[model samples]
Target: MTTRELPMTVPSEGLPARVRIHEVGPRDGLQNEKGTVPTAVKAEFVRRLAAAGLTTIEATSFVHPEWVPQLADAEQLFPLVAGLPVALPVLVPNERGLDRALSLGASRIAVFASATESFAKANLNRTVDEALAMFEPVVARARAAGAHVRGYLSMCFGDPWEGPVPVPQVVRVCKALTDMGCDELSLGDTIGVATPGHVGALLTALAGAGVPAPVIGVHFHDTYGQALANTYAALQHGVTTVDASAGGLGGCPYARSATGNLATEDLVWMLRGLGIDSGVDLGRLTATSVWMAGQLGRPSPSRTVRALSQQQEQ
Candidate 1:
């Protein structure tokens, strides 16, 4: 296979030369799987991902099994990763979830909130303000306990229940999360309805709100086939970090129309093409995606990987 490399010069937007790609396939990707993936398989999946040059991986969410039965083994799954040399982040909705994550020795944790009131009430059983308030204590306690915290501002683009999300709401939620001392904030296009224009405007608003650039990341789903485009827009606005999944493993269970996240292989391919170093091997990443697809008994949704593999076959 011929390797295509991008130039070393930085892009015009002055975005950072390299970015940290957060792999969420282990948790967010697997949580919606109807068929139970054995705990051993989940562990091995993460192991393969780590070998693929993923430094920050979301291991699992510590939510109750009643809510998401797929990730019920988070407690056991987390402790077993004692030897892995990477940042293992777990999503904790509230104090109970935080307790479970901390007990499992999670060094980094993510607390999430939605910008829309309806989505927040449905997803978190609280209003927008109420949800933010809940995480305050959780963040403070997590910080006091010496654990790093990241915040997820969901529905940054559009909401299923509510219509388009306003930039002020997104900015307010992000500022609150950052003010809570979250190490970073991941702006999520939960329903994947954001265009580059919307992403640029929202990011500009957040920057105007005095948030630091390096502390922001983008989580996009390919629902409208715009995940990669939105990511490029975010980059053009000077945002660095990004969240992706291998094989596009996870789609939104709540929003059935939503596609899986931006595939890590595709994201890496574009970044490498643009001379943006992600420090990930696209070939190895695709091989892992194929292995994962086999394990799940499904085909990968990465266009670049599928095309590359097919060309190689010919």
Candidate 2:
């Protein structure tokens, strides 16, 4: 059998000319893996990603060790790469988590919220309103402390327990975050079930409801293989920031059957083809993901990674 290669081309119009990729592989990606990735290897992962020209790298999460054992070394791990050239944003779930992050001089932090009540209960053990109340001071403190606060709203498209989510429900959460002074918000398709139409409708609704469209980012999983298509719709709707995992790593543990986030390499291919600048080197990015996959004892889940690796071998 032979594989036929088609030239990847970008749609000539109706997309943003430049896209900013927020690399989540180091934190969101590695945290979900079954194996315990050594601190040294994790440090190297961030270093390589930064070297590959990613301007924003989500360094690590400051969640409780009991909840997310994989990232228990957040305190120890963060110091190792404190002053990387790119922006390093860590996840802080509460006041204590924020304290831990700020103690280490973290200038940027993210707080995760859920658009669906079901997910909010499953993931945070709190009702939607309860969770938002908890994070209210967290976001305020981060902003007042001179830290850049990034908000993440998960289960934005659909929920496992609950069917398709309403766009206004998502917009309300986003409005809350933006009102709380979040510098940016990343809307996550937690189950990877969102189609392009869904994405467009949501973005359009968000804009109509007075949410700043440019400050919103899309975080998508590939469970249904619509991550890239949904992302294209987001771009068409004027979203510039995108959250992607290196080599297509990480997913919501609470969202049943959720897969990895959109791959940085795949997003880069589309951006580069459209003559859009992402500041990422495709060859170097592919090499970095392939190397990280080797460290994890598995092949990369990214289509772009597999295709580029084979092309390089040939």
Candidate 3:
């Protein structure tokens, strides 16, 4: 199929001319899958993502195999793509995870924190403050070795148990993570219940608190079909980094009602249409997602990938 061309001009006044896409399909997307994926296939997925023009592809997680057995091969996975030019950020849940990552020569790592007490206890088996305290030393140790640290704040907008999360609560957690030495923060809508209005309000609150927009990233799930709209809200507010999953392959394992993440192809399709340069090739990205869907024994959840794949078939 002929790939759609994107415009080079600034198409919208409210959007960033260029955005950085943080690809999390390999780790966050695949971690919850019931079927096990081979280490070699995981490495190839990362490679395919980079070749599709994603600069930062989260390669794997260093959590205990007992918790997330899908990424149990992090030790073997990191070695395959360590030499890649693009940034490979791996999720390290604790000091033990960090140790595993660093020993494999990883220099970029992510830690997760939750905004709501219910989610914190449910997901991490700790309170929100406890999770932050746990990550403090991990972030410190990683920084001591010159590793870049990204902090993820889950359930920032809505929580299944707590209902709507207060913006102040989210702000407090964000500040704590920043104070803990995270180079960047990725705010997650774990339940995908956020709309553009909620996003604008939270971003404004954060900006007022002096957390600059450039250092903030947004991770929205598409459960309610608002991920792309909410992403536009973030971009309009000056957020450069947006987290997406190739083939839309992730959900909160703890939140069973939650859906897959905002698809990378879906996001890229909008970015391209808005004349936002994300440095991604739409056709190549859709192809990668389609191939990955085959690996997972299902069609991709991304509308863009599904549509484009059909176009190719015709």
Per-residue error for 155 in candidate 1, Å, reads 0.6
Error of 2 at 278 (Å): 0.2
> What is candidate 2's local distance difference test score?
0.89
Compose the digit string of candidate 1's lDDT tens values, residues 16-109: 6888999999988998799878888889888888888889889999888888899999877887764698889999999999998887677798
lDDT of 1 at 162: 80
lDDT score at residue 280, model 1, on the 0-100 scale: 82
Q: Candidate 3: lDDT of 296?
A: 87
Point out where model 2 deviates above 4 Å: 1-11
For candidate 1, the per-residue lDDT at 78 reads: 83
Q: Tens-digit lDDT track for model 2 on 231-304? A: 88888889999999999989866765898989999999888767778889888888899999999999999998
**lDDT (0-100) at residue 68 of candidate 3?**
92
Candidate 3 residue 301 Cα shift, in angstroms, is 0.7
In model 1, pairs of residues that clash are: none
* Consecutive 10-residue window with the lowest summed lDDT within model 2: 1-10
Reference-based TM-score of each model: 0.95, 0.96, 0.97
* lDDT against the true structure, each candidate: 0.86, 0.89, 0.91
Clashing pairs in 3: none
